[model samples]
Target chain A: MNSEQQNATLRKMAQLMRDGLKTQTEPFPETEKEFAAILEELRRLDPGDLEGKMVISGFVDHPYGPDRQRCMECMYYLVHRQWCDLPELAVPVEADWWCRLWRI
Target chain B: MANLLWLQGGACSGNTMSFLNAEEPSACDLVTDFGINVLWHPSLGLELGENLQKMLLALTSGQMPLDIFVFEGTVVNAPNGTGEWNRFAGRPMRDWVTDLCKVANFVVAVGDCATWGGIPATAPNPTESEGLQFLKRDHGGYLGKDFKSKAGLPVINIPGCPAHPDWITQIVVAVATGRGGELSLDEFQRPKTFFTSFTQTGCTRNMHFAYKVSATEFGQRKGCLFYDLGCRGPMTHSPCNRILWNRQSSKTRAGMPCMGCTEPEFPFFDLAPGTVFKTQTVMGVPKDMPTGVDKTGYIKLTAAAKAASPRWAEEDIFVV
Candidate 1:
């Protein structure tokens, strides 16, 4: 996709989350087993179902905790393209965005 | 002539194969150039039946001077300590190890098996396997903690699943060429020359590691494997990247994670499900931090690095 299209998609996702989008953010995966289970849940979703991934992975537009953990710090984040490179997620993301899939 | 004797116990002979494949100071070079006399080897020894028995007996009885005793694999003491399962030359191989270790001037333990009991001694250890001088992190093994050869040194451990080929031959040559005393060993009795550096030293991915770029999947040549992939390169000691396997590349070089085979507690986490290739994490942070990194420091570093990460880090730099 073109840069403008990609930016629009990211903006749309961010707006959706900010507008009281209730996601599966309650159960934060504390362990790898728990984390893997969450990923497995994500895998069952259709790749084209971007909304399903965001909801399942606990997408928040901004940093969530005191540490200010965000997509920029996450291992799967791509700074140049402003994207989430995780094959399971594959969403356009803002650097300041937060998700449960975040890892350093 | 330095008479070198090689033996095996509860092993897969992986080290022997690696030894035979040595390039710089190859196995044949040991005989031709280094003047190492091969008294016997499990694979190379021509003796069979009565002749093999005679050779072993001769060495035990002090008729044949054993300059170096190279032991590969773990010493099996099984079936209620009888050691009857692995017999060599009409006696338990463990029996020969005891005798040979006593007589040999320098004793060298050739792989993870002989150094620290390896996978055979992992858990439930049905074979009752133990290294010549160590069992995992413990000092006392088949050979007692204080046990040393006639050269007044502990068993020289060159550990790996199969130790690097040059490490085996080079140590053997060092002992054979009257430089045995010059060889310095670490706490684990591995030669300080090879075992001193971490596998991360001199790695091609060091740039990625410094910039905190993570390689999420295997065979992606751009990012560091330590972040998400269970790579022990940063903490485990070995000169894999420096020396270069096959004189070209290492496990991490080709995008494979270092298994930390050189360390005594290898096959870490006991080959448990989801342990081998995936980095074990707690709350999305690595469970085992790099050697000395604390959680607070790691968090701070991550925050700074991620924020400061260059745009280039996100792109495929290794352009074809």
Candidate 2:
């Protein structure tokens, strides 16, 4: 996508997080089985269902927990693109943003 | 000439297939160049019926010198330890293995099945199968822990789902050529030359690994398979990258995860559903760290590496 379109999407996602749209960010999957379950849940949603994906994945604008982990340290995060690279959740994200899909 | 006897039990013959495909010192080279006498190999032997039994009896009775005894599959001790499941020539193959192990100058166990009981020995183990010298990490197996060949060496294990062809031939040549004394074995009895290096050594993904960039999918040439995929390259001790398969490429080199086939605990996680090809993590951190790395050091290194990763490191590059 063009820079403008990408920026617009990023802004929309940031606004959604700022508005406290309670995402399911707890019980971060502890194993591949649990991780796969989350992926399965995400797969059940319509591809256009951005809100549903966000809620299930537990997205937040700030760092999380005692370790202060965030998208910056996540394996799926693309540093230069400032985006989540997971095929299921291809969305623009802030470096410091936290998500349940986060993995080192 | 070294008289080598090969036998199989509860096996898929994968190692034999690999042996036939040997290139560096091919199967033909073993006979012509290496001076190895083909006493009897399942795939290459010319004996039939009574002749095969005669050859086996001669070896057992000290008429035919058995220089090397290479077993390629699990020694099945099923049916109340009667060895009825897998029969060879005339009697149970397990019995033949027992008799052969006693008289052979050197004993070699090839592939996962013959070395660590492999899939046949997986939980339940209905076949009552066991390796020559080990059942997974445990020491004693079909043979007692103290059991040593006439040459005084325990079973020299060359393990893999299908051991690399060259490893099989090279080790055979070493033993047949009277260099067995020079060969050193690790705890698992694998020759140190082949098992000392990790699979990650010489891996093309080393840059991506050092940078902590994760390869999210198969065939993505850019990142390392460790962080996201279920690659056991870092933890597995095998020269896959060094002695490339087909003399050209390794699993990691071709964008596939190292399945840890060379390690004793292969089919790791007990072949559980959704475990293969998927990295197992706990609280977002990997459960099995690289061989020598601790949790704290791993995390610190990851942070630094990810921060320092160059943009070029994220691009797919064909590895030779």
Q: Each candidate: how many clashes?
A: 1, 0
lDDT of each: 0.90, 0.90
Candidate 1: DockQ? Answer: 0.74
What are the per-residue Cα lDDT tens digits for candidate 1 across B152-269?
9999999998999999999999999999999999999999999988999998888788778888887787788998788999988899998888999999988898889999999888
- Taking the tens digit of each residue's C-alpha lDDT, what string does model 2 give over B60-102? 9989899999999999999899899999989999989989999
DockQ (Cα-based) for each candidate: 0.74, 0.73
What residue runs in model 2 are displaced by over 4 Å at the alpha carbon?
none
Cα distance off (Å), candidate 2, residue B128: 1.5
Q: Fnat of each prediction?
A: 0.70, 0.59
**Best model number under lDDT:** 2
Worst 10 residues of 2 chain B by lDDT: B311-320
